[model samples]
Structures are given as C-alpha cells and as structure tokens.
Target: MIISVLAAAVAPGAALLAYFYLKDRYAPEPISMVIRMFLAGALVVFPVMVLQRAVVLAFGENPFLFSFVYSAGVEEFFKWFLLYFLIYKHVEFDEPYDGIVYAVAVSLGFATVENVIYSLLDYKSFSQLLFRAFLPVSGHALFGVVMGFYMGKAKFHTGRPLGLLAVSLAFPVFYHGLYDYILIELKRYWIWLIVPLMVFLWARSLWKVNHANSRSPLRAVYSEDEVKLPT
Candidate 1:
C-alpha cells in the first residue's frame, strides 16, 4: 500500500520536478501543457512497449542484443517521436524550456505506469520499493531532462545554433543506449563498468545542458507569428 502511494506521488512529481529544475530561469510550463504531454506519452508508450517486447523475443535472449535493439532502441525512439513530433510543434514549445518540460512529462508518464505496475507486483518491502521508486525511475526523469534540455535548445535555435540541436538528440540516444545496455545485460561480472560510465555521461550531459541553456535567448513566441520548423 505504501509503495503504491509513494510510486503514484513520486512518479508524477518527478516529472514536474524535472520541468522546474531545467526551467530554473524560466516560467513553469502551463498545467494544461503538462497534462497534454503526459496524456500523449501515456497513450504512446503502449505501442512502443509492445514493439520492444516483440523485438526482444525475436532477436534471442542475449542480454546485450536485447538491451541494444529492443529496450534502448524502441524506448528512446518512442520518446523521441513524442517530443520532436507532437509536443515540439505545440505553441507552448516556443521556449527552450518547453523541450525539457514536455520531454520529462513523457518520460514520467512512461515511468509512472512502469512504477505502478512494478510496485503492485514486485517486492513488498519499502526499501525494495524505494530503490525502484527513486533510482531507476528518478534516473529516467533526469535522463529525460538531459535529453529535453537539448531538444528545447535545438528547437529554439532553428537548427543552426552551432549544431547543438544535433548534439542534443545524439547525446540522449547514446547515453540512454549505454544505460540500458548495462542493466539488461547483467550476465557479465564486469558490469560495474556501467556505473562509472553512467555517472560520467550524466555529469557530462548536465554540464552541456547548463552551458547551452545559459545562452538560450529569452524571446517571446506569443506575439511573433508562429514559425514552423520541419520535424
């Protein structure tokens, strides 16, 4: 019962926290926008999850292969589509912060459903639940922030902002790819390699996001005629 409660609260809260954390210097995203992003993710994850499972089953049970193609590929692909396609085009996406906000929303939506299901069925102890609630789940949110921060900047810059936009997409795909690669492929005794790697990659991503964000021009998209960028 406690796990269920904690998961429900933290899962959604984590998404909000990510929005504020990245939007540190900006206004919070409107509640309506957040809710819409969440709904999009909630609806989209089903198809992505189904494809992931199917690919995993077809390509053999090798942990490395499964993590690379199925888990990392499908999951990241879905999230990317939601961000770059649906929400990226929204009017709220005017600010670079929008990228982070919506990205985290989608990620949390995925995490929330994942957390509730795991909490409902998995270990009974608070410690066990907490571990799942915080680490992997929270990690997922942070990763979304990491990815969103860049996507936002990219969107803001009109694709010619020193190639930062490209970096944003590439970094998340690589970072997330490495993360799942280590966890799912848990057979090797030297799996500890992923730990330091995650820390390093995450820290690097944070630095890149902050540095780039500081330069994001504070411009209003409300009055300016809406300029559409090719997705």
Candidate 2:
C-alpha cells in the first residue's frame, strides 16, 4: 500500500515533467540541472508551508481570500522567486524554451511532494487519487507552462522584460486563484467550471510551447551550422 501510494503521488508530476521536457526541441537542458531545480522546488515547499500556516492563523478561515492570497499568491510567488533568482541568469538558460523546461521542472517537483503528503494524510480512496492527479497535479503543470512562456519571452525578447516578468507571475496567480476559488468557495455545481478552464489552459500552454520552440535562436544557429557542413 505504501509503494502504491508513493507511485500514485509521483505519477502525475513525472508525466508532466516528461511532457514539458519533450517540448524543448532545439536544445534540452542538462538532467543534473533539472534534478537540482526539482529538489530546490521541493525544498521551498517547507518554508511555504510555514508561511501559509502563519497566514491562516492571521486571516482566519475565509476560503475566498485564502485561495487568492495565501494559496495562489504565496505559492506562485515562491516558485517565481526561485526561478528568477536561481535559474534565470544561468548560462544554460540561453534559449527561450529553457525557461519552460526549468519552470515545469520546479513546479512539478513541488506538486509531487505536495501530492505525496496529501495522498498519505488525507486521501481515503482510489477516486480521490484520480481526482488529485488530474486537477491539482496537472493544474500546477499548466501554471508552470504559462509562467514559463512569459519568462521565456522576458529572457529573449528584450523589449519588455519587466512586463513579461510580471505576467509570468501574475497570470498564473490569477488562474490558480480562480481554480481554487471554484472548488473552495463556490462549491457544488461550480466545481464543473474547472473543466472548461482546464481545457483552455491546456490549449494555451501547448500554443506557448510551440511558440517558444519556433522562436528559439538556437534553431537558427543550428541551421547555420548545417549550411556550412561539407555535403
């Protein structure tokens, strides 16, 4: 049972990691760096938990505010903070797609650990496992994809890095807040709202992945190299 629960916890996050890793068609990041980022993301969870607990104590049990401020705002802030400070300036983060790769790595890492804890502590049945894998786990991946899309633009576009950075954090927070709000505050039939939202998020994330890949400067460089090769 322990092994099964562990596998269930990790399955969603691992699947998402593979999906985003494959999206980097031009140049894949080093596995070591990705692993390190994943671990760092997991480590951040502990501090975030402490902070969230304090927020809960201060704010009481307002579900709407908690979903927006504490859950979405705090969690996304830490994830973005880590990405910006730790990985943004790295030499390997040259291409735009690298942003998506690393961001998804970090997000899924956090999601994996969170999922394990929730599964072990709260989950009572197979249905709960399936629901969490689809909603919370996959939702984190989608948020990472959106955040990374703007972050990639910020790194490569050079026209409006600050604006893109803002979007990177703000966009995810808005959607994440809405996601939790539906389930937390609205309740009942409102939970169905997340279905369309998830569909939209998935579509948008896929488009962003394609856009980032198409705009990769490395692709052009590789093309130039191929042109100079002996025929």
Candidate number with greatest TM-score: 2
Top lDDT model:
2
- After superposition, the stretches of candidate 2 with alpha carbons farther than 4 Å from their true spots are 224-231
Please give me the total number of clashing residue pairs in predicted model 2: 0
| Model 1 Cα RMSD, 1 decimal | 6.9
TM-score of every candidate relative to the true structure? 0.77, 0.95
- Give the lDDT of residue 76 in candidate 1: 65
Question: Please, what are the lDDT tens digits per residue for candidate 2 over residues 1-231?
Answer: 988988988998998898899778887999899988888888888899999999999879688888899999999999999999999999989888898998898899999999999999997988898999999999999999998888989998758589899999999999999998998866678767989999999999999999999899999888888899999
Q: What does candidate 1's lDDT look like per residue over 141-163, in tens digits?
A: 66677778878777766547547
